[model samples]
Target: MKGTIHKCLAALVKEEYGEDAWKKCLQSSGFEPERNFALTEDIEEENSINLIVESAKVLDIPLKKLFDQFGVYWCCTYAPKHYSFWYVGMKDAKAFIIKLDEIHGLVGKHFNNAKPPRFLYHWTDKNQKVLKVEYQSNRKLIDLYISLVNGLAIYFKEEIEINKISEHEVELTFDY
Candidate 1:
């Protein structure tokens, strides 16, 4: 599932931002843009999104500002049996939730077969910040995950699903 989401995000960004432009954006935003496991430059799965999110928390910056620093914007489509994009901004969790609800309605109305709802957002836990969201469906749940990666460019952050005790329930912890 993770690999598929990675591929989908790659494809979409290539289509939207161009490969070279996207790579430059990632680099300028302080991501390695390469595969390495043990450094902040590397985005190994466990450390990938959470690392960036934590940086944002420390610096008191919004994800969108980070992406803006890199000169990028994005758009994607949800297709048959597959939802294609997710994005996160730093401020106003409420507005973001409204947008997600609007997306859910749009996709549900268009597809005629509503999949389960998936959410992505930041929250505070015990005076510490965590970013998270969830989606469940037949396809790989790529939309939210890809949005998460893109969100990292903006949020400069990382997040993880700390618990998934059932098919329908997920608990995530973010580090930004």
Candidate 2:
């Protein structure tokens, strides 16, 4: 996991739930109340999971709800503001999704011990409206991935019908 993720999660919690809640969440997760994660720093996977679980617990929300909210905040607000270069020529959700794997690869190059998820895509329909995306990651954060896709739809102001094909696959039908 990357510290950037932790940083974004912290920001989301502080902005939406207030600083006190964020501090409590961090303390409950076995972290110092004032701990800060550097954007490019490496974070332990277990610690990241613990932080997420504790955040949900502290906020009195379901884990999936937290994931959903974080995904939207990361995709639409945090990433765009912090990594504007990544969105240089992105026109829509489809364009961004198609380039996600490549973008991750580029991101990995800048960080030590980075192991971002890999995405493989195939068009299911002749007209290319439906896309089947295969997600590969040791972390198994499929719910978060699905939420991020939903966030992409919201970010682009596009209607996307998403179907979970399996634990590691999804079918996205785009309305264009």
Against the unseen true structure, what C-alpha lDDT does each candidate score? 0.42, 0.92
Give a tens-digit lDDT track for model 1, residues 1-176: 13322333344445654676545544645656662232112133534344344433434567545333322232223221243334434243334433664676565565533443555444547644443445545544343334434443344333433554344334445444
Q: Number of clashes in model 2?
A: 0
Model 1 clashing-pair count:
18
The candidate maximizing TM-score is 2
Model 2, position 118: C-alpha lDDT score: 89
Model 1 regions lying over 4 Å from their true place: 1-102, 110-117, 120-128, 142-176
TM-score of each: 0.31, 0.97
| Candidate 2 local lDDT, residue 73 | 96
